[model samples]
Every structure is written in C-alpha cells, then in structure tokens.
Target: MPLIDKIAWLHLHDGRILSTRSRGKDAYYLPGGKREPGETDADTLLREIREELTVTLDPASLQLRGVFTAPAHGHAPDVLVQMTLYAATYTGQLQPAAEIEEIVWLSYRHRPQVSAVDQLIFDWLRELGELAE
Candidate 1:
C-alpha cells in the first residue's frame, strides 16, 4: 500500500469548523495540504494555509491534535493517508486559492457532505465538545 502524508488545520469558531472544497472535487475537507521535501509539519501547514486559504498561520500557536490514518480521500483503495492535525490561529481573510473552490463553515450536521476521514474527524471533534452536535 502507498502511504500519503498530509496535514490538516483544526480551525474552530463557535460551533463550527472551517472546511474547504477543491475546485473540481466532490467532497469537502479541512484546509491543509501535503508536505514539501525538507519541510517540517509547522512549515508545511503555514505554507499550505497561506496558499490555499490566503492566511498566515502562527507557528508558535500550533498544537498537535492527533495523527489519523485512513483510506486516502478520492484515491484508490490501496492508498492510505496519514494526516497530522494541528490547531492554530491565523491572520488575514480567508479566500479560496489555488485549486480551492470555496471555503465553508461546517457544523456537525454537514458531515455527510465531507470526505470519510473528515466525517471521522467531525465525529471526534463533536465528542470532544469542540464542535456542536
């Protein structure tokens, strides 16, 4: 099986979480991306958030939430993604950039519209009282 590593930001406000949909994709996902060569997790997340959401993440504020492994979203069954999650504050307004089509505020009820891994995350967040049920 091929292993794909990625990062996701857990940005929450009130009872909602920030999610994004790629320009030509069908499912919603937490805003983040893959790591570049020679980059640390903090470096990857900061750069990815800037590129995809037009916001700069404060590296010092990053908190490692969890590491999740799942069948890669939109990929073949043999592919799996190991996603590292971090929580941090960002500066600048969020805009859909690069391949992103839209930025959405998702509540627990919106789980069905997101990817399988995102659904697991949403459930986890809800159980942790970080999200509204």
Candidate 2:
C-alpha cells in the first residue's frame, strides 16, 4: 500500500473539533499538512497552520494527542494516510487562508463530512467524552 505521512492539528471547542476544507475539496480535514524536509512535525505543523488557518500555534502549549491511519481519502484504494495528531493552543483567529475555503466546528454527528481518518479520530474522541456533540 502507498503511504502518505502527515501531521494534524486538533483544536477543540465545546465538544466540537475544528475542521477545514480546501477550495476544491469535498471533505473537511483536520487543519494541517505534510512535513517538509528538514522540518520537525512542530515546524511543519506551525507553518501549515499559519498558512492555511492564519493562526500561530503556541509551541510551549503543543502536545501530541495521537497517531491514526486509514485509507487515504481521494486517493487510490491501496493508498493510506498516517496522521500524527497534536493538540495545541494558538494565537490569533482561525480563518480560511491560502487554499482553505471553509472552516467548521465538527461533532460526531458530522463525522460523514470528514475523511476516513478523521472519522476515526472522532470516534476516539467521542469515547473519551471529548467529542460528544
């Protein structure tokens, strides 16, 4: 199977999680992207977040939450995506930037709107009572 390694930012609010969709995408994804060479997950994530969401994540407040993998959305059947997820506090407002076209707070009820891996994350969060909405 082909593998795509990426990082994700998990920002929660009132039992919901923040999700974003790019200009031409159909499914919302956790706000983050793949790591560039010579960059750590923190480095890649911070830059991606700022570029996509216009927010600066607090390095001191960043914490690894979990890693998840599933069939890569919008890719071939044998392709998979492995996501390293981090929870962090940020400065500045969350707004669409770059290719981002929409930002929404997602609950378990909205699981179908996200990608396969994101649905798994929602399931895990719901079990922990963090995404009960």
Candidate 3:
C-alpha cells in the first residue's frame, strides 16, 4: 500500500484538541497536511496551518508528540497515511481560510466525526486523560 506522508499540529486546550473541516468535507482532521518536496515536518506543519488556519506557528515551541499510521480517509482501502504529529505554540488568531470550512474543538466523544487517522489521535489523547469532554 502506498503511504501519504503528512504532518499535523496537535494543539490542545482545556482537554480538547483543535480540528478542522474543509469545505464540503464530512470528516474533521488535525490541522495540517501533506509535506511539499524536501520539506521537514515542521516546515510542512507551519505552512499548512498558515494556509488553512491563518496562523503562524512558533518554531521554537514545536515538540514531537508521536507518529501514527492508518488507512487514509476517503481513499482506496489499502492506501495509508503516515502522520508525524507535533505540539506547538502559534501566534495570531485562528481563522478559517483557504480550504477550511469550519474550526472546531473536539474531545474523545467527538471521535466519530473525524477521520480514521484522527480517531487514532483521539484514542491516544483519551488514553492520556487529556480528552475529557
């Protein structure tokens, strides 16, 4: 199976994580996307978040949380996504832009509303007791 390499920002606030739903999309995803050629995870995350959420991430605060792999949502059955997750501090107000349709704060209870890979993230957060509703 082919793997879609991606990076994601894990912004947690008051036990909830930030999520984004793009225009016409049914599932929410962590606020980040595919890495451009030769881009580092931090590079991809900073760029994607700026494009989708109109915020600039603080590079000094970037931390590696985890890397996860799961079947890619909305793709062929065997296609996979490998996501490098980061916890980072960002500057500027978060406003939906580019392809984002909505910005939502999600808890473990909101798992069903997210993609397969994101569901895994919710599970991880719940295991750490950081996703209480």
Candidate 4:
C-alpha cells in the first residue's frame, strides 16, 4: 500500500479546531501539508501553515499532538495518509492564502465535512474532551 506522509497543525480554539478548504476542493482539511525534501517536521509545519494560513508558527511552541493514519481521501482505496499532528502558537492573523479558499473552526459535529484523516482526528479530539459537539 502506498502512504501519503503529511504534517498538520492542530489549532483548537474555544473547543473547535481550525480547518481549511482549498480552492476547488470539496472537503476541508487541517492547515498543513507534506514535507518538502530535506525538511524536518517543524520545517514542514511552518512552511505549510504559512502558505495555507498566512501565519508564522512559533517553532519553540510546537507540540506533538499525535500521529494518525487513515484511507487517503480522493485516492485509491489502497492508499493511506499518515498525518503527523502538532499544536503550536503562531503569529499574524489567519487568512486563506495560496490555494486555500476558506478557513473555518470545526467541532466534532463538523466531522462529515472534513477529509477521512480529519474525521479520525475529530474522533480522537472528542474522546479527549477537547472537541465540542
């Protein structure tokens, strides 16, 4: 099985997590992207967040939340996505940038509107009493 390795930021505020929808995409996703060549997890997180949300993540404040794996959305059934989740502090206002079309705060109730991996994340967050219904 092929695996899509990606990093994601878990920015929860008021019991809702920040999520993004890219232009022409139907499902929302967490605000990070794949690791570039020679880039560390922190590097990927910072770069992706800045590109998608226009915020500079505070490197010293990055915290490993968890790693999650699920079927890769919109891909072949045999493909999987491995998401490395992080919680961090950031600077600047969060605005949709680059390919991002919308930014929203999603609670557990919004699970159905997100990607498959994000649904797993919602379950995990809900179980931990971190995500609101």
TM of each candidate vs. truth: 0.96, 0.98, 0.98, 0.98
Query: What are the lDDT scores of the predictions, listed in order?
Result: 0.91, 0.95, 0.93, 0.95
Candidate 4 TM-score to native: 0.98
> What order do you get sorting by lDDT, best first?
4, 2, 3, 1
Residue 20 lDDT in candidate 4: 93
lDDT by residue (6-66, candidate 1, tens digit) is 9999999998999999988989999999999999999999999999999999999999999
Model 2 whole-model lDDT (C-alpha atoms): 0.95
Give the candidate number with the greatest TM-score.
4
- TM-score-superior candidate, 1 or 3: 3
Which runs in model 3 stand beyond 4 Å of their true positions?
A: none
Which portions of model 2 miss their true places by more than 4 Å? none
lDDT of 3 by residue, 72-98 (tens): 999999999998999999899999999
The TM-score that candidate 1 achieves is: 0.96
Worst lDDT run of 10 residues, candidate 3, spans: 124-133
Off by over 4 Å in 4: none
Clashes of each: 0, 0, 0, 0
lDDT of 4 at 1: 93
**What's model 2's lDDT at 106?**
89
